[model samples]
Target: MRSTLRSSPQSTPAFSLIEVLIGVLILALGLLGLAAVFPVVVRQQRTAADQTQGLIVARNAEAYLRGHTLTTTRSVPNASVPGGGLLAPSDPIPEQNRRGLDILRYQGVTATNPYSTWSFNAANPDRPGPWEIPTYSLVYTNPDRGNMLVAATNQTAGVQFAQRDRLWPAAYSSVDTRVDDNKYANEPRYIWDVATRRVDPGTPSNVGDDGIQFAVFVRRIDSSIRVSRRDLINDPNDPLRLSRPTRDLRLADVLTGDRLGLGGVVTLQRAEHRVAVAVTNNSNSPVPTLNGEGEYAMPMRMQIEAIDDPDGQGLSRFLLPSSATDIQRRLLREPGQKFVDNLGNIYTVVKATFDKNPPNTSNPPEVQPENERRSILVSPAASANAAALAASGDLQVVFTPQVPAAVHVFTMEPR
Candidate 1:
């Protein structure tokens, strides 16, 4: 056959060594580009997911604040702490308890300090900060939420709350001044430190809560605004009452350019709106009826309500303390009386005290354009007009029989 098959077509020409190397180099470059692209793609994807979740969390918090806490009617002050009272950086609805949310509110209402938010206690009831303080709230048990103590600090493993035992003597140091003085003296310690993610050894958690554990961090990224104690207090009667800034306090502007608006940081605006859900249990109380707010915790205090009017008029109110001295006289002063609410739940009356105003003291002389003596509902700061009004007896007292008492309509378990 034409042995000229050309000897098997002379074996296909072998690729040159340089040509092969170039081909390999091209393939390697393609793979390198893909590898680089993968990380970027992953990062972008993660950011998008975080942002979406954040929006939901933020809105939920906003709704909760509006629903539970009352927003102070603000009137941007013209001067720094205009009334010269106990100034706080934030609007101190209760400078002493603005967001304290401690059940102690009901306890001390009839004491020397009519209300904690109105008074400052050096030994007990540690005041947190010009931060969001809870005055009223209801906590319910939700086992579905797992250990959240770890989540508060963004850690994989959480600190054992029970191991820490919130006893003030155990966890605190004599020289510890950064926290409230009553750091861990109470039971059911609730106030948690974000930096340490540990319960404040001095504050009360719920009546029987093992401890507070949350999945979301009370994420804050703003620099601390050293708010004046005078600024935070409210002087309802002071014509020159200092008010909050008309505009919102922004994190980026207050602290660094890098702020919570960016994905990796935390920030704080105020307490009313929470960015996360906070829960704890053992009380097994029913979830309070929430408003159109989001699924978030209200700045709440662990409160105990008494329904029995020892006077029987149903108008007799009680303000009992849980302090050492108060406990000794608990049965004598705050006699227990069984009561049933609309829900048919029974609660034992804890204390009974007069709802009448305390006796007026020899008014202290004015200091720095304001009164130095601040009572339970009294603000130290005042305006010239406030003084004139007080003198004329035209100044309206925040507390009076006119203001209706806050009695739980439904029945709740008594502490």
Candidate 2:
């Protein structure tokens, strides 16, 4: 009792069980909140990296363009090349000199053979129009093959860039190397394309003849997606016109499965969509009468459809599908994304519209579809070309690789 009395003050009470649990709960809640931010941080980092790389690539392209001097005279197409007629011999779009800016015209526009030329947009008169193919003489003469050339195997069917549209970060051949020691091999952070158009008036007074003002369009390369190109057939619903698939193309099923859907028919009932393609040399070309493979580069050659706007806004909308096969679901989610169509039309995605979900339940589960209808609105509305193609009786089943990617424009005087 004397010793207890000697203890001046009672010692502070120990923490109870409830206090410990509460402390743990608070810590866990904070950790969970922190964990949720990690993915967002990662995405932001990736986006920033992409943008940085894009700018660097664009600058490199500008340097390349500036280093090369433009040929003033008209270049005649060589008769030696079999498809020489389709190729542009010189720089079709002019710079300071108005005389050089001439549009190339061909006899016909076929599905298998889409033509490219210089196009003007009233909406943005200061910048250049869309790009289909680059000028021949300028790219061919350049010595930098490592960064400028796209692998021949990667070329889009029916549509070939002047030489190779893609500009790789590393050597083109090392894109998929198997060297164990070379961990960095084939891991390109970014790939890009370059197109040019005149900016200022073609006048030597403003910008010297040699110092012509030009706009360089540098677009990022996203993905190389392959889809089947069905033969153009008569639309039963509209006898006069060729058929556009009433239902969305079952891209994922056809690609991932063993057999392709039968008769190229758009079926309401979901079935096994597989096309077992057998090739001798592993050629990537579309198979004849089988699941033909058409490679489309994201933001470059990725296909997007023109949406029907009831309000007469002249908006070009991309129909986004809930299906996993529809690449739009993952890519092209942001506005201001730029892409050039096969018709040499450049479009900037504006905003995403409402997502239409499919029926969740049905009497027969097998009959129930998993995809929903989604639409993305784009600006500089589609020209009459899309409608004309759909109406054209010729093989209209051609897959237009509409590439929409990050684009950087540079205004510089070519040296």
Per-model TM against the reference? 0.23, 0.41
- Each prediction's Cα RMSD? 27.5, 18.7
Residue-level lDDT tens digits of model 2 in 1-415: 4554444456756889999999999999999999999998997886677667666766775665444333121122221101111112223112211111111222222233222122233233333333333332332211211112221111121222222323445333332233453232543333344443333222212212222222234333323323344332333423422434332222332322211232343321113232122111112221222222222121112334334553468775555433324343433445555554433355666765543332454334334332333456767766666544323311011111222224554444433
lDDT of 2 at 85: 17
TM-score of 2: 0.41
Model 1 lDDT per residue over 190-298, tens place: 1122110011112232211111111111211111222112221142433333432222222121221111221233222333222112222102221222221122223
Model 1 TM-score on a 0 to 1 scale: 0.23
Clashes per model (N, Cα, C within 3 A) = 35, 15
Candidate with top TM-score is: 2
Best by lDDT: 2
CA lDDT of every candidate? 0.25, 0.35
